[model samples]
Target: MSIELDHTIVPSYDKLASAKLLAELLGVPWSPTALGPFAPVFVNEGLTLDFIQTDEDFPVYHFCFRVSQQTFDDILGRIKRAGISYRSSVRGPVDMRINTDYGGNMIYWNEPDGHQWEMLTVSYARQSA
Candidate 1:
C-alpha cells in the first residue's frame, strides 16, 4: 500500500485572498468556498491546500514545493510581476536572488501571514535511491 499527502489546512488572515494569491502565483485552480469555511487551492490532482481563516495567533509554517525548471521559472516570473520579495536563503534577507547551490534553482518568500514559501527545481532534502 502507498500513502500520499492529500491536503493540508493553512491558517490565514484572509483565506480567500491568500488562497487566490497562491493559486495565481502557481497558476493553479482554487475556489473561495470549495469546502465548508475553507478556500481550497488545488496544487495538483493529488494534493490541495485548504486555507482557513483564523484570528488567534498561529505559528508560521514553511512549505516547500519541488517543481520543474520551467515551472519554477514561470512561477517566479509571476511572483516577481506581483512585486513579492524573495530571497535565496531561507533565513536571509530578501535580495531578489535565486540560489543555485543545490545544483538547481531555489527561492524563498513569505506570505502576508508570514508563512515561508519555498520553490525549488531539485530535491535537496531527498535521499538518493
Candidate 2:
C-alpha cells in the first residue's frame, strides 16, 4: 500500500470564510461545516483541507500546489480579478510577478490568516529529487 496525505487541519480565525475563499480560488468545493466543527475544502479526490477556528496565535504555513500551465494561468487570473496581491518569490515583495527561474511559472500569496499559498506550473521539488 502507498501512503498519501488525506487531510490536514488548517488553523484559521474564521474557518468558514477562509475555507470558502481558498475553495473559490482553487475552484474546489467547500463545506461550511464538517465533522467536528471543521470547514473543509475538498482539494481533490484524495486530499482535503479542514479549516478549524482558533483564537490563539499560530505560525503561518506554506502550501504549494503544482498544476499545469493552463491551470496556473486560470488561478492567477482569478487572483488578479479578486484583487489579491501576489509575488514571484516566496519571501519577496508583492510585485505581482511570476517567477520563471525554476523553469516554470510560480507565484505566492498570503490569505487573511497569513498562511502562504503557492501555485506553480512545474514541480521543481520533484526535479531536484
Candidate 3:
C-alpha cells in the first residue's frame, strides 16, 4: 500500500488575506468557502492547500510541499525574479536556516503568519515496468 497526502490545513489569523497571498505565491486562485471559514488553494495539480481560521492565536508550524525537479527549478526562478531573499543549505541568515534533508533538494521560507514553508524535491527510483 502507498500512502499519499489528501490535503494540508494551515492555521491562519486572517483567512481571506492569507489565502489571497498564498494564492498569489502559489500561482493559484483563492477559493473561499461560501459558508465556512476555510480557504482552499490547489497546488501541484491535485494537492489542495487549506487555510483554516482559528479563534485563538495559532502556533508556528512547518509545512512542506514535495515537487518535481522542474517545478522546483521553476520556483527557484520565480523567487529570483521576485527579488526575494532565498537561502540554501550553505547560505546562512540571522534568524532562518535552509537546508536539504534525506539527500533531497529543499528550500525553506516563511509565510505571513510565521509558519515555515518548505519546497522539496525527492528523486524516487523508477521501478522496472
Candidate 4:
C-alpha cells in the first residue's frame, strides 16, 4: 500500500477561530464539523487540518506549503494586508520579505498559536555536502 498524510490535529485555544484564520490565509475552506471533536479545516480533497481546543500550551509546529506563483503572490498579499509579521529566515528580522535561497521564493509567518507557516513557489531538492 502507498503511504500518504491524511490529517493532523492542531491544538488551539480557540479551535474555530484558529481554523478560520488558517483557512483565510491559505484561501481554503473551513467549517465546524463532527470529526472526532475537531474543528476541521479542509485544505484539499484528501488533506484536512483538524483543530482541537486545548487549555494547555502545546509545542508550536511548522507547516510549509508548496504553491504556485500566483497563489504565493495572493497569500503573501493577504499576509501583508492582514498585518501579519513575516520573515525571510526562520529566526531573522520580522518583515514582509521573501527569500530565494532554495531556488524558490519563500516567506515565513506565524499563526495565533505561534505555529510557523511557510509558503514557497518552487521545490528545491536537498543538496549533498
Tens digits of per-residue lDDT, candidate 3, 73-106, equal 7776665575555555423562333455556676
| lDDT of candidate 1 over 15-48, digit per residue (tens) | 9999999999999999986749899999999999
- For residue 73, model 2's alpha carbon misses the true position, in angstroms, by 0.9
Candidate 4 lDDT: 0.87
Model 2, poorest ten-residue lDDT window?
120-129
Return the TM-score for each candidate structure: 0.97, 0.96, 0.69, 0.91
Candidate 4 C-alpha lDDT tens digits along 24-108? 9889999877656898888888899899999998999888888999999998888888888899987788966899988779998
Candidate 2 structure quality by residue, lDDT tens digits, 33-113: 577889999999999999999999999999999988988988998899889999999898999999999899999999999
lDDT, candidate 3, at 12? 86
- Kindly give the stretch of ten consecutive residues in candidate 4 with the minimal lDDT sum: 120-129
User: lDDT (CA) for every model shown?
Assistant: 0.95, 0.94, 0.68, 0.87
Clashing pairs for model 2 are: none
Best by lDDT: 1
Runs of candidate 1 with Cα error greater than 4 angstroms are: 127-129
Task: Quote the RMSD, in angstroms, for model 2.
Answer: 1.1
RMSD list, candidates in order: 0.9, 1.1, 4.5, 2.2
TM-score of 4: 0.91
